[model samples]
Target chain A: MSRKISYREAMRAAMHEALTNDPRVFLMGEDVGRYGGTYAFSKGFLDEFGPERIRDTPLSELGFVGAGIGAALGGLRPIVEVMTVNFSLLALDQIVNSAALYRHMSGGQFSVPLVIRMATGAGRQLAAQHSHSLEGWYAHIPGIKVLAPATIEDARGMLAPALADPDPVVIFEHAGLFNMEGELPDDWTVGIASAKVRRAGKDVAIITYGGSLPKTLAAAEILAADGVEAEVIDLRVLRPLDTATIAAAVAKCHRVVVVDEGWRSGSLAAEVMARIFENAFWELDAPVVRVCSEEVPIPYAKHLEDAALPQPEKIVAAVKGLFA
Target chain B: MTRKTPVNQKIEHRPPPPPAGPVPWDKDFALQLLLDMLRIRRLEEKAAELYGEGKIRGFLHLYIGEEAVAVGALHALAPEDNVVATYREHGHALVRGMPMQAIMAEMYGKQEGCARGHGGSMHLFDAATRLYGGNAIVGGGLPLATGLALAAKLQGETRLTACFFGDGAVAEGAFHESLNLAALWKLPVLFCCENNLYGMGTAIERAEAQTDLCVKAASYGMPTFAVDGMDIVDVHATMQKAVAKVRKSAGPVFVEFRTYRFRAHSMFDAELYRDKAEVAAWQKCGPLHTFTARLKAKDAKGGKAKLTEKEFLELDKRVQAEVAEAVAFAEAGSWEPVEDLLKDVHTPEGTVTAAPQASTKAGRAKSPAPRSGRRSSKPTSARGRR
Candidate 1:
């Protein structure tokens, strides 16, 4: 049996399961309770879980994020929501210095079993401050695991295992994916350790994750129309990148084009390309290339915002360049 | 500099601190408090001596003059309560029941330390005591304390969290945000601010437009109390009241312990900020001698009361011996192998829990501690003595 659901609904279902199954699990964030979450993921959780479990916080991101780390250290599985990736910078010190370093710094005496979920990407026309995709910055951190779930099944499954991990896990839910409609099969399970091939082809390997996955898939379809088969690999776990799966895909399809919504320099795509060079450099029939956002603050104008982020046309162009 | 006026001049116009009455707690408890303060003083002196000899290397912030804040305040709370302290936390770690050997070994960068040498002096941690961290960032631990209080409330536990930060943290955005959240949520947190006047060479008058700090916590609707940090008696009483109220109401209370740091901020500081006369004046009002004199004079039963000159000497000798033993233990401790450097980066996969080192003699034997260092013969005068 399969269930048709929005990515937002699937995420809510996952949170609802965790909150219902575990007494230690609670949700806290700005607008997560009374305002039904900034994305309305917890529409009825406030009334159901009560104010104690479904907490609403002030604009104090650093304070609450630090509190979340403390709550985790004190033995509660807290799922904190930072409304967006941009605002999370305010709490970066707590996340990087405190939460991430606590377990190691304390010499295994502590582990922050914290999950911070935030919306990222540049489609909302929210301009400079709110529209940058900075998941690469988070993935660069060592002690924390980063995940970018681009599908409904992952949206419903990753939270459980992320909550289970003994360290901090940051989930970047691209703002564009929430409203995406997808089907969830009864036994559709997911793990946060490896990449998944959404579409298979023998000619070229198109690698991406999060919001860029759909655009890359679309580009793959466009390439197929031109007789160039493209295999699409979704890097489910951003940190601890699944080099084996990427290597296998590279072996089968000698040409690779990486797609990311972040700017070109020092992006997650750069890390992926570097890994590809290190692990599967000999298998490459062509030099690996990347389709990344332009190096500019995401603008408020609709047309400029579209240009600033990775699009299907850009991915298709990058893939064709790899062929050329 | 635009204007060459000295900022340390503001120290002359100081607020009148709370008075130190006779030893309010019974003889045993008061003596225990004095002993704890002595333990801090002697241990730091040995640590300073070791630092000079090049054994301990790091930004070591000795709690020479501010012993009463951690000693008196920690005594007022239960064992289950959480404690979050600033970087200058060797004293806080000691009084919270962490063995001196573990603390010293940690500063020595050995595997037997409280954090297994992962954290040095600025980041001591002990899960057993529920001490969160020796956080180095200014105002960093405030939010952690507020969250610990939140968890205690949500878990239906009566444990309150005590967060200690210096006056330097008062001007931080974190202090304001954490206070606002705790007040709004009614979390059981004790914001213990040790106001030592200078925020690393910047006086309170210059750093804050409104030098009165209670007004900041008050703006968040928190109940505020200011006590003389030099008086261990006052520190204990104020924290007792603060802890009790916070537990009863399940709300946060902010207490500002007006104190002084008689030493340079750290081993690295030049001591160029304040006048020597001011240090001399504050030393006369020090928590140790003043309280000792008051205890001796108020003994109505005369000559052989609980805290006699002989008893004080015995306690001092005991403290000196303990410092020597801890130093010996640290000297004998082993460094962690390079291969195990990545061991605790993230905890090992299995669902392991915190196993705090035992504070008993059997526990101290966990490390191959050598009790061979020569003991200091007598209790020296207070450290950082120019």
Candidate 2:
């Protein structure tokens, strides 16, 4: 049995289930309670869960995020929501310095079981300040697990496991995907590791995640019309890049194209391509190619923003160039 | 051709003298407080010697002149409460019951250290004592302390979280943010500011627009206290009341202990910022000798001696012996092996049940999995690439 639901609904349902299931789990962030969520993800959560569980924090990212780390250390499962990745920079010191380094620095005496959720990507014309995908930067950290939920099922399932994790977990939800509608399987179960092969094919592997998944899949559909079958791999977990699945896809397709929303230089796509080269260089038929955002601050102009991002047309061109 | 610039006038710096009063504590308790101060003084003195000898390396911020703050405030808290301190936290760790041997071993980077040789002098952590960290960042521990109190409030725990930082941290954005958050949430946190006058070489007057730190905290709408940090009696009395209010009301409180550090900021700093006379003036009011003097002061009206000079020497001798034992333990402690360097980066079983797909790989690798979860497929060979 399956039902169609929006990504926002899926995420809200997951948080609701978590709150109902565990007494230790509480949500704290700016506008999480009275203002609902920044994206209205927690619209009625305040009334449903009460003020204590659905906490509305002051505009103190460093304070609340560090508090979340402390709360996790002091024995509470905290779901700290930063409105967007751009604003998370205010709390980056706490996230990178204290939350990520505590367990290792303490020699295993403490583990921060904290889940920090933030909106990412640039398609809402929010301009340079409010938009930008920095999930790739977070993926570079060693002490944290980074997740990007592109599908409704993943949005519905990733929260439970992230909260269950003993270390810090950062979840990046694409800002453009909140209203994206998809069918979620009734028994939607997902893990925090490994890449899931959304659409299996044998010609070439189209590896993408988060906001770029829809664009890459659309590009694959166009490739399919032209009789060039492309395997679509949704990298749900980004930190420990499911190399085995990636290598397997590389072995089968023998060609890979990475699509990312982050800028070209030092992007997660660079890392993905580097890993593919490291693990499956012998299996590859050609060099792995990538389609990333242009090197510029995301502009607010509609055409300029569209051009700055990784689109289906651009992904198709990159895949076609690979065959050429 | 260059123009001649006007010379700026230099300002004079002078610290206040120690408070004059009879010893408030009984002979035994006063001796105990003196003993605690001596233990820290002796331990860090040995640490300085060891640093000179190349045995203990890294930034060593001694609490030589600010001993009364840690000694007084820490003793006022319950054992169940949490403590968070700054880099100059050897005194805090000792007073909170972390074995001196383990602290010395940590400075030695030995395997027997509290942090297993991972964190040096700046990052001591003890889970049993509920000591959160030896946080090195200026304003880093404030938010952590606030969060710990938030957890306690939410979980209905009676324990309070006491966070200690230097005057320098008051200039940080994290300090203001943490204070506001703690006050807004009404969390039970005791913010202890050890105002040692200088952040590295910059004086509080030169760095902050408002030198009154308690006012900065008070602006956050929490009760604030300014106490004479050199007097252990004042620090302990103020902390007792502060802790009581926090535990009773489950709200935040701030205390500014007007203290000073006698030594250079770190091992490398030169005492060029302030005059030698200024240092001598603060030394005249040093917590150790001043408190000892008050204990030995003759009541002009003929009261009993608070603490005899003989008892003071006995406590000093005992503290010296303990410090010697700690140094010996550090010398005997071994180094952690290179092979186990990555052991505790993440929890050992972090990937066991969290990732259901990885279980198949674990099975093929013949590794025992910790949690039995829903399996995805019939044991696919991990080696099956093509």
Candidate 3:
């Protein structure tokens, strides 16, 4: 049986299942317990799991994140929540220097089975500090797996596999998608690699993930009405990018448009476009185009912030340009 | 909160303080500690020589004057307890049971090295002994130790995590945050601060407002102690008490082993910051000779038999031979193949398999439904497969 649930509830259910199933699993982050998580995703978990498992932490991102790595080393599964991608910068040293490099640098003697989850993207007028997507920055690292769960099933399914993985995994949940409702299957099983083609089309492949997935999908529907028939690919795994699926998409549709919420310059969209150019350039019907956030700090004003981010209209426009 | 004007006080260069208590005089135990210190001294001395000979490349931070800190404290902890150390950790790795041959080969960047030549001198890691890493980032290992302690606590294990860092790490925000977190959670962590007076070329006094490291740690409400890092007996004794308290789940304890580095911070350091006279003064009371002198003091006093001159010579001889054998092993060690350079980035199970070739079929091939009879017992699923 399948049940309809919000992405936030689906994530909460996943974590609850992990906590109940594994004694070694614990959740630690600022206000994860008492304040019921910054996004309220962990609401009521404190009372259910007790203080030991659902731990609230001070605003010490570097300390707790590093502690998560250490706990992983000491034989415990820890899910460290950094509130948002913006705040994760405070713990970047630990994440990059310790968590990402430990396994390879330690000559594979230690595997940090640590999971770090953070809300990403700018849509709620949070301005420069809280806004901006940096998942691409994390994806650039070699030793850690980067996951962006766009669907309700992915939100519910990704955490278990991530917790089960022996290396460090960073899961970025779109801040905007927390309240989005979708149906989750009773046996929703998903892997953390390869892009899933959300909508099939022959004209152009609209590749995107995370917060941009819905926008691209909406744009694809718009394109479909205009007889463009754009295929939509949700790149669930960012690092160790599923190039084969991407290449296949490119072969199926000669034209491509990459939609990303991160800034246009040196963005994940750029990397995806580059991969297509490298792997399937001969199959290209036209030069690939990208619809990304403008290269500026996401402004506070709603109109400007909306203008700065990639929208469905912008994605549709980019796909039209690719066809042109 | 009004900010106070910073005072520019002239710092005084001083020798390492004397031992707080009498040497725990047990012949075998004392000899074992002495031999451990000697092994580190010989191994590092040979490493420095190799660095000069162009055999060992990269930054080499020798634990010449701070041997007692690693020797004494590591000996105090049980074999099962975790150890996290900083980049200046050849001595800690040696004391933590990493083979000298592996460590030497790692310094030579050979396939047989502890980290399989991936990590050079500054990144010695051994999982068997739970020596996490030779973390190069200042104050980087502090939170890792805290997390390890948290894991042990969560698992209901009595094991303690002993972390070693230099005084320079005290200035980092990670140090303060980690200390507060460890103390707040009452995690079983033994923070052994090796205060060798400088963080690279920057002296502690120049970099820190509160030069007393133990005072900084004590602010977190944990039991903080200062010991003579050059005194092996004091270090071991202090560690014993600290380890016992942590094992009893009394929360974290901070021990500041006040020591000094006899060599430059790394091979690249010109050491233009400190006076040569200060170095000479610290070297006068170096852990090697001072402890040796104390051990041989019984002979001069005509007291009962303790560590004699002959015993010291024999131990030194054995350490020198071990160092020689380690060098030979490193010399014979082969280089890792360039083709395998990309390996170990992720565990084999977690590796991202190559995607299937793009199909021209009309519809996307749906992944087979997961076998419903048995739950997915494997922690990680195969990538690029249904």
Q: Each model's TM-score?
A: 0.93, 0.93, 0.93
What are the per-residue Cα lDDT tens digits for candidate 3 across B2-117?
22224455445688564433356678888888899999989998999999999999788888889999999999988878899988899999989999999999999999999999
Q: What is the DockQ of candidate 2?
A: 0.27
Q: Kindly give the stretch of ten consecutive residues in candidate 2 chain B with the minimal lDDT sum.
A: B353-362
What are the chain A TM-scores of the candidates, in order? Answer: 0.99, 0.99, 0.99
Clashing pairs in 3: none
The sequence of per-residue lDDT tens digits that candidate 1 reaches over residues B46-165 is 889999999999889988888988999999999999999999999999999999999999999999988889899998999889889999999999999988888887777788999999
Q: How well does candidate 2 score on lDDT at residue A219? A: 93
The pairs that clash in candidate 2 are none
The alpha-carbon deviation from the true structure for residue A175 of candidate 3, after best TM-score superposition, in angstroms, is: 1.0
Tens-digit lDDT string for candidate 3 (A1-324):
677889998788778767765667789999999999988989999998899989999999999999999888877778999999999999999999998998778777777888999999999999999996999999999999999999988887888788877788999999999999997665555777678999999999989999999988998899888999988999999987999999999999999889888888899999999999899999999998988899899999999999999999998888888756
The candidates' DockQ values read: 0.28, 0.27, 0.34
C-alpha root-mean-square deviation, each candidate: 11.0, 6.9, 6.7
Candidate 3 or 1, higher DockQ: 3
A1-324, model 2: which lDDT tens digit per residue? Answer: 677889998888778766755667789999999999988888898998899889999888998999998888887778999999999999999999998888888877888889999999999898889888998999999898899999988887788778877889999999889999998765545788789998999999989999999998899999999999999999989987899998899999998999999998999999999889899999887888999999999999999999999999998888888889
Best by lDDT: 2
Which regions of candidate 2 are displaced past 4 Å? B1-11, B299-303, B350-386
Question: Against the unseen true structure, what C-alpha lDDT does each candidate score?
Answer: 0.86, 0.86, 0.85
Candidate 1's C-alpha runs over 4 A off are B1-21, B298-304, B355-386
